[model samples]
Target: AQSVTQLDSQVPVFEEAPVELRCNYSSSVSVYLFWYVQYPNQGLQLLLKYLSGSTLVKSINGFEAEFNKSQTSFHLRKPSVHISDTAEYFCAVRGSGGSNYKLTFGKGTLLTVNP
Candidate 1:
């Protein structure tokens, strides 16, 4: 079975500061990792993903994550964050082989960018 863990329930940072949201995954076989963000009344949106190819993946919004097979981790980071980046972020994992269409997600981390 595959699972995702987000240890931080909430992360607070001042505007224009750097932030990192930790994510860890566990699986017996190869897996696909994803990070989703949810705004205050909006549905979850895909932030970034690690499917194949490069071990390092990035998002357009200054966020990046590295797929570490040895450590089984996919931590998300951003050098500079804005108030608009304030939202809940979720880490998910799914098996790569099957078409199960099931993704195990973490509890989510709330990022609050203060002024």
Candidate 2:
């Protein structure tokens, strides 16, 4: 499967802060970019996707990411964040080699929002 890897470590700070999570990926054929956020016990939400159109995309919760073709990676970043943003973030890609639509996620990023 097309693989995506996020390099963001542990992001920790006070409530209502700004944060950025970096992500990278490798693919031989065409691919789609995706960002998902995982809450405490929830699965994940479709933050955004870069299919075959724009290079810059944003989510409903103020999170955004850019697709870099040269670097072969997609990075997520936000200027201001909230306690609700505390969760695990993942970067994924769908390989165009075949009909497989499985996503290869990164190790995961932990965003800790403290009061």
Candidate 3:
């Protein structure tokens, strides 16, 4: 069984502060890790992914995560968050290879950035 787990369902922070979102997974086989951000009813945008060969991966929007093999985790972090960063974040995983790219999403972590 492959599954993605986001430990926190909500994260609140003031503008300019740093934040870290926790994620973990358990799989009997290899899997691909991904982080997606959703703004309201819009589709999820790929924040970052850890496919292979590299443990550390980063996103264009100043977020990064490290893939730990032993712990089975990929935690997201940002140094200085903004008010514009307020959105719902989801952690997902897909089975390696093949066309079965079905992404199992977490419950979602709502990042509320207050001014």
Best candidate, lDDT-wise? 1
Work out the TM-score per prediction: 0.96, 0.90, 0.94
Which candidate model has the greater lDDT, 1 or 2?
1
lDDT of 1 by residue, 67-112 (tens): 9999999999999999999999999999988675688999999999
Question: Can you rank all candidates by lDDT, best first?
Answer: 1, 3, 2
Judge candidate 2 against the unseen true structure and give its global Cα lDDT, from 0 to 1: 0.84
In terms of TM-score, how similar is model 3 to the real structure? 0.94
Superposed Cα RMSD, model 1: 0.9
C-alpha root-mean-square deviation, each candidate: 0.9, 1.5, 1.2
lDDT of 3 by residue, 1-115 (tens): 6888899999999999999999999877789999999998898899999899989999888999999999999999999999989999999988897776777988889999999
Relative to the true structure, how large is the alpha-carbon lDDT of every model? 0.94, 0.84, 0.91
Residue lDDT tens for model 2, 1-115 = 4677778668787776777788989888888888888888998888999987789998887888999999997888888888878899888888865787777888889989898
Best by TM-score: 1
| Cα shift from native, residue 51, model 1 (Å) | 0.7
The regions of model 2 sitting more than 4 angstroms off are none
Can you list the residue pairs that collide in candidate 1? none
Error at 49, model 3, angstroms: 0.6
Better candidate by TM-score, 2 or 3: 3
